[model samples]
Target: MSNPPELPEFPSPFNFINNVPITLVELRMRNFSGQIREKPRWWEKVHDADIVAKWRSEIIEQDEKVVEQFWGGEKRFDDGNGEKKWPREKITGAQLDYIFDELKDLAQAIDHETGIQRTAIDKVYQSKTLIPADLKTVFLSGVSILESVPPEEQDWHPGANDQVLDLVHPSLHCFRIGRSPVLIPERTSGCPDPLFVLTEEQYLEMREDAEGAIVSQFISTNYQWLPTDFEVSQPGRRLYSNITSILQRFLPLFERVLSDSSDPPPPLAVAANPGGWYEDEESESDLSDDEMDARWRKFHWPVIHDPAPFSPPTQEGRTPLSLNGRKLQVIIKLANIVLTPERPKYPGGSWHVEGMVNEEIVATGIYYYASDNISESKLAFRAAVGDGTDEAGVSWNYEQSDDRGWTVAFGLRQWRSMNQELGSIMATEDKSSLGRGRYSAFSLSTRRGPSSRRATFPAATIVVPRRAGKVPALRALPQEIWDMIMQYALAGTVSLEEAKQDRLALMEERSHFVIEHNREIFEVEFNMCEH
Candidate 1:
C-alpha cells in the first residue's frame, strides 16, 4: 500500500475559513502589506504644479489673517527702529515666501476622502464643528452630573494622583461578557427574533427611563443640584442624550476609519516622490550639520518604491463594511483635568491602546469638548507594524552600501521592531472651546459577538475608599495577619475562606482568557511577502 503524497497548501485571500473569522490585527497587517508600495491619495495633488501654485497663491492672500488667527492676535515684528510693525509691513520677501511654502505643504498633506489631517494617512480624523451649535446647551446640562458630585465624593481616576476626575468611566462598571450569569433566555427555534438594539427611538426611550432613576437618587441624597438636572433624570444612563447626539454626529468619521482598517482598497501602481530630500552627495560637502541631518532623513523614512498594482483575494460571501444591522457595544468615558496655579502643567499621557484583548475594542473616538488656561496638548498615534523578523527575507535584501537607496524607497529600518510613527492631532483652546472646564469624552466601540453577554455591577458591591488615613490597629499587625484581616473585610461573609478560594479561581480564569485571546490575535507572525 502506497501512502498518499502531502498536498502543498495554497494561500487564501479570504479573511475566514469554514465560517470562522480572522482577527482584526491580522486584517490590519494584511491591509498594511497590500498598500506597501501604493502612494497616498494626496501624492499627486501635492505634486501637481498648478495645484501647488494655487495653494501658494491662496496662502499668500490669507497670510495676514492666518497669522492673526494662529497667533491669537496681530503679531508685530521689532524693526531696527523704535517702531514695532506688522510682519507684512517689516518682513522681507524671503520670510513671506517661507511662510507661504510651509502653509502650502500643510494644505497639500490633507486628504478629503479620508478626512485625515497631516501626513498620517487615514488613521486619524478631526473636525472643529462636528457637533451642532444647538447641542451645546444639552451637553452642558449633561456636564452638571459631574459638577453635582461633592468634592469629597468625587471619583478620581485610579493612579492619576487626584488630577483626573472620572465622571463616567467604563473601567469602573463595564460589561463583562461570559463571566456573569445570563439573565435573558436563549432563543429557541420557534421564538421570534429580538428587535435591533441602539435604534434612535429605542435609545431615547431607554435613556429617558435611565436618566429619571439617576436623578431620583441624586434628589434623594440632596446633592448639589442645578437647573440642568432634568437632563439626567434617569438611572443606568451615566451620560445624557447629549453624548449620544455627539457620537451620532461623528459616526461618519468613525465609519471611515473602520472601513479603511478593515476592507482597504487594492494598492494602485503609482510612484510618488515627496521631494526636498538630498538624493546626491555632491551638495553634501557645503551643507551644515542640521541640513545634512534633515537630508539624511530620506534614507530613514519609510517609503515604497515602484509599487505594483495589487488585487486582493475574493471572498464569496463577505459582508461589506457597514454598521446598519450590526450590534455594537459602546463604552463611554467622561473625564476632566483641573489645572490651577498649584498644578499648572499636565505632563501629557503615555502611549497605550484603548482596551484589553478580551474587550474586542475595534475603534475609539475622543472628543475634547472644553479647556481653559492650559498649554497646547496633542494626541499622537503609533502602530505595531511588526517585530522585524517578517521583513528579513522579503523586504530587507539590501547591503550596507545600498542602505540609502533602500531606505529612501522603502521607508523602513532593517533588523528592528517596526513601530510606525503616525502624526498627531493638536488639542487646544481654540479647537475645543465649549465650556469652562477641560472635559473630554471617549467612546470605545466593541463588536458584540453571539457568545458575549453584558454584565452589570451591583450597587452594593461598589465601595469608594475614604481619603488617605492610617489604620492604627491594622498597622500594628504582622503582614500575614493584616492580609487575612483585609480578605475578611472584603468578603464580609461567614464563608470567608471559600470566597477567597473562589476569587483565586476566577482570577486565574480571567488571566487565561485574556492571554488566549491576545495570542489568537496578535502573537502570530505576519507574512509580509504575501502581498
Candidate 2:
C-alpha cells in the first residue's frame, strides 16, 4: 500500500485499510501455501493432516481476534451503578477487495472450488464455497492450485507454520452483497460446523493474523486524525481549480474567492466538531441557543451585511475562477451519501449537502440536475447562490440516530419533503411509509448521449464529501490551508481566518472514510473493522 493516508471519517479511530503494508504483504505471500492433491496419499505423504486440521481452526480464530482488537466496543454489562463497556470496528472495503483479488487467483489455479478455498487460507481463515456437500469433498480432494503459483514462487510460498495443521474444510458458505459481484465475510464466526481443531503448531498462525490486524488498526486509527503527508497530485489540485464546469452551467452563481481584498470576510469562522479532538471533553457541551439560531439563518440563506462591502452572489458568467489568482480554503463536511432515485420521468435529481460552522450552515447546497442534451452532458448541476435553503423553504434536513446516544438535531420535515419529490420522480413509494419512502435515497444511472455535454449534474444522486456530481475531480488546494485548520481543530481553538481550512479538513477526512470503507450501513462489517 503506497497510499499516503488522508484524513479519515468518524475521526482517526475509523478508517480504511489502504494496502497490506509492503513488508507484511511480501512475508505472508510466502508462508501460506497448501499442498497439491495429485500426489499419492497426499494428506499423509505430502502433508500432515492432523497438523493442518489444527492450524485451520486457529487461523479462523486469529482473524476474528484481529477484528475484535481494532473495532470491538463494549456491550453494556450490568454494573451496580450503570452499564460498563468495550469497543468494536467493522471490515472495510479495502480488506474485502484484497480478499476478492486473492480469491480470484486461487480459483483459477485450483481444480475443485474447495481446492482454491483451502489454498487461500491454508491455515489462515477458513472459507468454503456454498456448493453441495457431496460435491464439496470431491472439490477439496482434487483441487490442486499449486500450479496457480509460478514455479519460482512455489518454493517461495509460505504456509502459516503455526497453524500448519488446520486442514481445509469441505463445506463452502460465503455471502454476496446484493447484485454486486464481491463476496464478504460471513456475519457469524461460530466454530465452523464439522470444524476440526488446530494442532499446537497450527495455532501460531492466528497470532500472526491478530498482530497484523492490530498494526493495521493502529495505523488506521492514528492516520485519520493526524495531518496527511500527501503531495498534491492532479486529483488533489483539481479540488481547488477555478474550472467550475457544473457551476458555470448554473452560469456564474458561484461567488468563488474574492479578489483585491487581502482580508477574508468575517463570515469565515471555524468551530470544533464535538468528539473531534478528544471524544466529548465534558458531559455537558458549550453551544449557546443564539449560536444555534444563527446556524439556522445561514443554512436557510446566505447573510450579507447591510453595508455589503464584499459583493454578494450575482449571476455573472460563473464567478471568476480565481480570487486574486488563488483558491479559497474550505472543508465540505460530508454528512452522508444518499443514492436517491427521484422522479423517474424527469431528467432531474438533487443532493442536499449540509454541515455547520460557527453554529451556522456554512456548507449547505443543493445540486440540481436537468438534461443538457444541447451541451451533450447528461448530468450538469445547478447550484444555489449560497449555502442556504431555497427561496421557497421547501426543503429542510437533519442527522439520523447514532451510537453515541447524544441528542442531536434532525430535519425530518425536510427529509419528508425530499421523500415526496423523489417519490414523484420514481413513481414508487412504500405502501406503509406512504409518501415518505422507506429510505433516504436510492441509486440512479446517468446516460450520456453522443454530442451531448456529458450529461452533467450536481451531486444530487448521493451525499459525498465534495460535489463530484457536478464538478470535475476535486482540485487540491494549497497544503498550507489544510494543515492550518487541522492543527487548529486539534488544539481546540478555531478562528475566522481558518474557516476554509476547517471545512476542507473535515471533508478530506470524510472522503477518506468513504473511500477506505463501504459508505452504506448494510455494507459495514463491525467484526472485521475498527469502529
Q: Each candidate: what lDDT?
A: 0.37, 0.24
TM-score against native, each model: 0.46, 0.17
- Model 2, stretches more than 4 Å misplaced? 1-231, 234-239, 242-353, 357-359, 366-440, 443-531
Task: List candidate 1 segments past 4 Å from native.
Answer: 1-120, 175-179, 187-239, 265-320, 386-396, 400-416, 429-531
Kindly list the per-residue Cα lDDT of model 2 for residues 375-430, writing each as its tens digit.
11121111121112211121211122221211111101211111101111111111
Instruction: Give candidate 2's error at residue 328 in angstroms.
Output: 7.0
Sequence-dependent TM-score of model 2 = 0.17
How much is the lDDT of residue 276 in candidate 2? 33
lDDT tens digits, residues 1-531, model 1? 543332222211111111111122222222322222122343455456675567445544555463354323322211112111122222224433433343345455444543434222333455455555567556756676665778886766555556667666544422222221111223212333211123333323432212432222211110110111122557425456666676566566555545445453333223334232224455668889998876655333323332232333355543334444333445565677755444444565544333332233345566666655454455554343332244433333344433233233333333333333333445532132110011222211222322111111000100001111110112344576446455544433324344334434444444454454333322323333422
